[model samples]
Target chain A: MTTPPLPQWTALARDAVFTDPTEMLLKADRFDQTIRRRNWREYAAGVSGVLLSIGMAAFFAWVGDYAIVGAVMVTGMGFLVVMHNLRRHASPVERLPEEPCIEHLRRQYRYQAEALHSVASWYIGPLVPGFLAMQAAIFWNAAQDRGWEEALTDKGWPFALIVAFLIGVIALNRWAARDLRRKLAALETLD
Target chain B: MTQAAEALYRQAGAQFAPALARLARSVERDPEKARDLEQEMHCALWISLARFDGRCALKTWVYRVAHNVAADHVSRAVRGPQRVALDVIETLPSAGNVEAETAEALVLAQVGELIRRLPPVDMQVIVLWLEGESAADIADITGLSAGAVATRVHRIKALIAGHFQSEPAYGVTA
Candidate 1:
């Protein structure tokens, strides 16, 4: 197979690099929106967890159930621990150093690897433990006064809804995992 | 953040955005995928911005982020069997002021097909070169030594030259 001429290659490169005006701006705006939305979701979830714990504790205290209050505290504390662990494990962003050109690219590849790994951890870390802890709490609370069937029936719908939500969350997590894995593999090919 | 830091990011974005986007297009071969890569790079850059201590040129930092983002994308594409094929070179539309749009399109199509056949690294080198990256800059972005960059460029040029020698009517001789 003969190689194409320089002019042809140059022309091809020009076409490849040239941006469509509408598409370029639209992409930038869309990217900005995605970043904003992702940040908002994370913030909202964090706030919601804290609020839910506080509300649960207060409601239990008002009803004079010290035991339930303690449980709520444990749950709240567990959530905080998970959050702290996540923060600790989060990758630190690299500072670019003044360097010769080749060094810069090498650093860039290293940074990319770090960032991809960080994202992968974020996707897979909490779901399993968090799901188990919540389920255990539900069962423990329900078991205090009645059999499993009785407890389930009394709050079956809500429990069922929670189960459904967990399933949905897991499914979404799997999809994300698959996506990240693909990206990581592609990076490996480059190196 | 210092004024200098913020200004650095803005400058980095302006300088690196097009080249990074072009790289994404070459690797991903789909506009939508290219857009996704761009956004991911933008987010990565924003996250990493705080660590910018004026140690390196902002352009290099941005390219590093862009390359990482693209690498991640390529990895993901590999694991997903449903990913579109990488034979995108055959589909690229030609540029330049040709009188007949069809001829332009055909030339572009052939060029794209040939490009896809090159090794991935060569593809990257050629694409970056076409984007006006100097050999030194290409070495930096690609993590290859300068000598290696020259060698790869020489090989790529020869390959393109040979490809056109056999198809003269295409007017693609190097």
Candidate 2:
């Protein structure tokens, strides 16, 4: 026997209520705009933080104040730690269907893991260097204000500390990105 | 976007809106939820319009976006307690126009319920098939190869046929 043609009339009856598409189209546009605005807001926040860091460095340098510079360094480090923790702890936004086929579910999870890894790398790769550069500029400027001998002797310990901190930050960022990627890859291979 | 892009959006909306609504209703199983999904899909499509590089037919792209939106909305609804209150419980006429329409609606509703029970990929294939999408179009929308779509279509049809045959009282009237 031949297979039946699809019940086109039945489908049409089901959709009888939604005859107008204009409203749907408009709502879609509005949602798109909202998402775009959200992304812009996140970008603005990041730019603002970077600007504040630069501003603090400049203000402290003009006043030859190591105390204020030290405070700013601590504040910047604290902000980075908070932002990193918040990002790391964020829940996955897209939830999978409850009873998806095993194969399909696996594929979906793999895709998500890959995406998360991409995002983590995208964030960490530039963040480490940018963070270190800002810290260096601030510390170096404050040290230079003193006479050459005094600056060299006084700044040696602080400069060494900053270098160590930079190395640690870069290593930590790279490790976090790589570890997340590896864990996600492992999830893809699980039963 | 240019005027041509804007016109395309308008034209695509006019041409595909009814069909998209039908597809959403079939999968969503609730009217209010269907409307919500439709709105979301429409919004996504418009936003994604700029990225449409003419690599695929406009209809195929619209269907893919609509299917994704409906799937996402339904998943959320199932997980949440906000049980979609049956939209106003539409009244059906008792005779002639209403009778035929009601019979048709009942059949479609049963079909929709059955389709919902299938695996997501299979359900998508069946819906696309019912929408008169070609194998090639289904492949494009699904990111599956043409051969894979054809195989899945055969398996899905047999599954639906078996389901209707086994559950005689489930609206399979002579």
Candidate 3:
């Protein structure tokens, strides 16, 4: 192997990269500040998500007939946001700088893959029970206006629309799961 | 633990600062970004030392961390543009007009640029070998088998030999 001597590259690096010793000494101090800032940003986004979910729940609850569906959605969105924020911002590896790079990469991939696959649990699953309650409530609330048979028959098309909507939500989650699975499979090759 | 980590940081940082700088410089073309990467490398070393169990040689550990950081920096930089394989690069021609006086510097810069474009595994081995690491050391740092490092080193040598114009006084030049 006739490898060219790389003195020029080394020289260029030495000239360009070497800094005052003080800079090296103070790196940890600066890193602390960066970490604090990042943490603040993460918490801020999470708080906003919680607040938005509350607002959504409140607005939908005010709609009377759609109150149950709205509450379920609020719960679902809140759970998803909280779990996602935790995974995205508060990764253990970010603080554990000593962890090998390959380990870090694998950790990140693992988190993302789990997050993607969990759309049903933290996201869609939370909505399922609440959604069923909401549908039952919709029929009951409609029944107060007329006879039970009248309410059921009259509300048929609207109930069909709501069922279609829920199916669509699950389908979208499945699509996301499939996409994440592909990414996870690709990432596994590196491990 | 803090004092031990700090002492180790200073010791390792002093020893490998030059190599880490070279790694960062190889990854980033912009001086400002390279400086930032260099600082990041230092910070990483300090944090990484807290967990340094000495399972591997200190030199191997440092490059593992340094190259990982540099590769991440390079990956971020390359995300905006399409990257080609090294084979594609091999088919391309080298610049022919660099004067002997400036040929060395230009070649070094071009080599750094070429390195920045490579995939992470290839990039890591090539960077360590170019920086004068032995095959065993490269394997230690990269977690690749010794045979793998030898094969990669061979390929890198051939790649460089084919692409870079050589002079009799390569590293001896001013």
Candidate 4:
């Protein structure tokens, strides 16, 4: 345990003019404006999702497709669930000034890990029932026209594809969660 | 931002900009990215100061914001497997022998390289220590215990001292 004089790295600061506070403030103002605009866009997009879902549900119901209507409603509910989960778990890009670095880091890591860990429940689960119902409805309708075996052969691939895609999403999220947990564990050792 | 907050931001920039640059450089190997990181730190600091409650010293607040930004940048930019633990860094080979006349820029670059390899916490501690921050200040800024900061400082000093031309280690000038 030696207390050695460090190189004169601070001298670099002497001649360095990093940024003007006024310039930064102006930049901050522009940044805030941009974020505000982006947030409006996000809200608009979310509203569009809800409206589209509702519109589709209504259209399907009017067309005498109760199963499709049910599927649309469930999928819309899934969208809301996913949005809620995101609001709950998402970490802000800006950090509190007074919060300690380690605490901040820990909080961020925890949020990311937890979000990924529960991806199936909040992200994938809600949509799954809808997908299955829709597939089942499609299968049932097809079976009414064509034979059951013929319908399965014709409409089954999309079902398999959807299931496979959901599985892939779940796996990827889990893997990402595992990696974040490992990093979090390493951070914990510092405590 | 308030007038006081603006004044504080100016003061912090004047005081810690160099150290912040060094921190950014240590965390990012690319000079361009380092500059971007430094700008990001400034932007974060300015934004953070709007809520400054006068609870902590301006320096502490400044460094905390800057370090947090840099830590986040490192976390986002570099994935695991590239950063090594503190104990692992201790076991790694030193910069080897250096002539007394070794240019300060080269030594600084070597220091930056070595620092970039460290885990985030240790990296923050050592960077603050290098910038002449006391152990208590480092603890306050990093949220590590004072004793933890001290232990890290001691080990980091010993580790970095190996790179310089010094007798009894860590006595090199420039």
C-alpha TM-scores of all predictions = 0.49, 0.50, 0.69, 0.82
Better of 3 and 4 by TM-score: 4
Where does model 4 sit among the CAPRI classes?
acceptable
How do the candidates rank by TM-score, highest first? 4, 3, 2, 1
Which residue pairs clash in candidate 3? none
> Least accurate stretch of 10 residues (summed lDDT) in model 4 chain A?
A1-10
lDDT of 2 by residue, B124-147 (tens): 666777766778777777666677
Better of 2 and 3 by lDDT: 3
Write candidate 4's Cα lDDT for B1-174 as tens digits.
Answer: 789988888888777778788788778767898888989988888878889989988888988888888888887874534777676665333333534254455566566666777878888887887787777888888999887887777676666566553534336531
Where in model 1 is the C-alpha error above 4 Å? Answer: A1-5, A9-44, A61-68, A81-92, A95-191, B1-104, B110-123, B129-137, B145-166, B171-174
Q: Going through the candidates in order, what is chain B's TM-score?
A: 0.69, 0.72, 0.83, 0.85
Candidate 2 has an lDDT of 0.57
Model 3: per-residue lDDT, tens digit, A100-172? Answer: 4445455655665566556566666655665566667667777888978988898877878977886787677
Ranking by lDDT: 4, 3, 2, 1
Give the best candidate by lDDT: 4
List pairs with backbone clashes in candidate 4: none
lDDT, candidate 4, A44-94, per-residue tens:
777887999999989988999998898888888888777766666663745
Query: Model 2: runs farther than 4 Å from truth?
Result: A1-4, A8-10, A13-108, A114-191, B74-107, B163-174
